[model samples]
Target: MEKKLKKLKTDNARKQIKKNQNIFNIWTKLLRISAIWIRFFQWRKWHKDHTYPKPQVGPLMVAEIQQAKERWITITQRQAFPEEINSLRNNQQVVRGPLRTLSPYLDNDLLRVGGRLENSNISANRKHPVILPRQHVVTEMIYREYHQRYMHVGPQGLLAAIREEFWVLRGRDVARATVHNCLKCFRARPSSLQPAMGQLPSARVTPSRAFAQTGVDFAGPLVVKLGLRKSTTTKAYVAVFVCLATKAIHLEAVSALSTAAFMAALKRFMSRRGKPSHIWSDNGTNFVGARKELECCFKKQLTGRTVPEELVEEGVQWVFTPPSAPHFGGIWEAAVKSFKHHFVRVAGAAILNFEELSTLLAQIEACLNSRPMTALSSDPADLQALTPGHFLIGTPVLMPPEADYSEMPDNRLKRWELVQKITQMFWKRWRLEYLSSLQSKAKWLNPTANVKIGTLAVLKEDNVPPLQWKMVRIIEIHPGKDGIVRVVTVRTASGQQLKRPTVKICPLPMGKEE
Candidate 1:
């Protein structure tokens, strides 16, 4: 009987491994396809612009003529784009970068648009059709995602690199901005730009690397009174560092809310977990603006853009998001939410002190990390039951659950050296294989166009049936170069389509009044 049970368990384990491998295969294929498209887009940036090179300057001022015969520039080649780019071509800005990633729908469309080196990630995302904003993330995160996708340039250089890459893919006029904004280009100043160096991170680099990309944040100044004396009160702070890939966390409670206190907590983590690559947080005055502005009239004139900073030099990079926006740092936000539940409800409505709370945090983290997660939905037994630690670090640690940790590769390398090497190596290999898979899956080329200008389109959805309406004017059309659109709609009354990036257009309605 015992042998039978053991055999069943072994069989289940083997089955689980196979299931994980299948998911990995599909995900990697997506990455490979995306990578090739990016490589092609990088090639054609140097091609020249069509139509009399420079804009024709005369009394005629015929925009229609310019729009009709204009040519599209290869974003990578730094050439010219087609004039039919958009109706607002005259006012459009021609910031250049490579177009990376092709649309899945169209066989030949580039997914990302590009601009000049001077343009920031925010600028490029706004200009291109492919790099749209995600639902839960802030705009900065959107930029971060774009840089990760291309792996060609940093946030600042995305605009330029995108254009260069794009030209290689199609060598066509991208959107309307280049032609409209060319005249305005003279106002721009010149400066040297740094290109992106490291390979992109592999589909999240899960594994012990889970604890590598951590986000640390302080949850509160919990005013809890404890100890034998009734007057004795404790001021405490929760310092949490969560692995990005694994979602496993190392949490603690400290006595005070000072920079000094935070440093002590960090040191504790390093002693055990080792140094992390990135530490995300909210720009608290303690962790951020320690230095006062140097009030020198002469020195102040030297540079206008400066933010106050109080850096922690523990051989780790500290990334801070905007104040009051906790969601910007994903791990920390989740940690706090989980901690609050325990602190307020589970651990008794009673308040906790620095020491007691810290003890509680350790317990909570263990439970959260050990439990398998449902997200790795690919596994049948625990595919859904995989734990957060498994998610971040990757399954089947060097030392499985039964054994202690046998090796620590990070310890041999200096913190920063480890960071750079790991980021470069993992990102390089992952980008190649995984990106190809992304390309195969995200079919953007033959997008289904829903509505057109002058056509009366109906609002369609399941729950909001009555919310639907009749004919309305089609004011605008959001069309990618491939012709298919993401959304189509009318103005007023029973209308649908909440804030999506691309939309179709149709003809205006004839009557409005009853």
Candidate 2:
């Protein structure tokens, strides 16, 4: 009985949802039809009441075309449409009679072609088209008003919308030109070009031990059940440590984003991989605090006081890139991206407990470390491409082989010498294959002329109107070591200063006098 009741409830819920969707579809269709009808009526009223001048087609013809349209309308109304309208609409009405040429398209009180009424002689797609006068500011005003009505849709959309009720000469050309000069459209579009690529840093090219020069970053605020009870929960953050030279990764799960949490994560990393010489990361408050703590510890030890052995011996240096600069830490940022990619799939919709989440992160770290650094060899006879594990463990982590080393007569020689030789060989291959591969710049192509100070620009925002764009002037330019300008500081008319990337700004094309 209970099972039947539950099934009935589910069925009723689905039926209700379907009924609501059908109603919504019907209402939407009615609204669209009504809007189109209202737009047609407005166009008809506008055409009947407004008088416009002739458009300039060049010299040889110098009279108003609006007067010609008026004359043609009067002739058609009085049942006097000439057999040839070339002299009535296309030509100035210098002559009028039954002998005048009538327009080819004429039907009972309406001009009809292709079963459609010809309200005006201007044809964007018709021959013997009634030419709209250039002085017809009302026609252009109608076009502009319609363009704004559609939220600045492009020329093609505007042409389609305007063609439904009335016709105008060179309508497509006018729409195209109007859309081209639209300030709103220009502010919303993405930048067409970018500055040149910056040079690679020395750490990227230099050979070093795995994790000796590391980049650290945080990835998440994932919620995990804390205690045995499902109701108890806490937030967890993942700290990612990526080796700059080899691209190997280490992940630590911390309880919070704080100085204590980061310090603990750093200690865990150091414990397994050994202390890094230099750590590169963004200027997060926790990271800054950790650096201060490390300095204090070093000072205490220098004063002859006992400190943690790792703190005294490590002598780690924390290097912070500028604030809001994620690209500067792209190495570790990419590593974080990789971790999240695998994590989402593996933990899909599961509210894991803390221990479970931690274990999964460790497994993800192992999988990333084992991935091939380059494409796999197609030939069965050739060895596979080298990975970060090859530098760290002298073998792939995916299928770690059993220990096999030659026994030496002396205890110190065999184990130590073989490990050193294997690491040296890996570094040699890394320099030849991996380091050389980083030479090309995949993005930020050839540089253009630098943006000069005092230049006017609009700060781009998501889903904002063009008129609402903040007017700003470039006050400072920040060029990377490669001498390519990617970021700049701008001051608004309100005296507010903001630092924005070049991608987020659209500089106005200025005239020499302006």
What CA root-mean-square deviation does each model show from the true structure? 30.6, 19.0
Residue-level lDDT of model 2, residues 1-514, one tens digit each, is 9799867864564344334332422322323433343344445646766553322333212233333333333333333334334443554442444222322343332332232334556553342333232223334544566788889988999987766644555688878755755556666653422667777778888988899999999988998897767687778899999999899999999889999999999999999998999999998999999999989879889787587666677699889876556877899999999999999999987878888988998899888988887667689997667898897777767765677544636667766897788788888888877887898889877678888888888877657776677878999998887677778898999899888777666787442223
Name the best candidate (by TM-score): 2
Clashes of each: 102, 14
TM-score of 2: 0.64
Off by over 4 Å in 2: 1-153, 157-181, 190-193, 283-285, 288-315, 321-325, 403-415, 460-471, 492-496, 509-514
For model 1, the stretches where C-alpha displacement exceeds 4 angstroms are 1-208, 226-231, 289-314, 376-384, 391-514
Best by lDDT: 2
Q: Please estimate how well model 2 matches the true structure, expressed as its whole-model Cα lDDT.
A: 0.70
lDDT tens string, model 1, 35-60?
A: 33323323332233233234333332
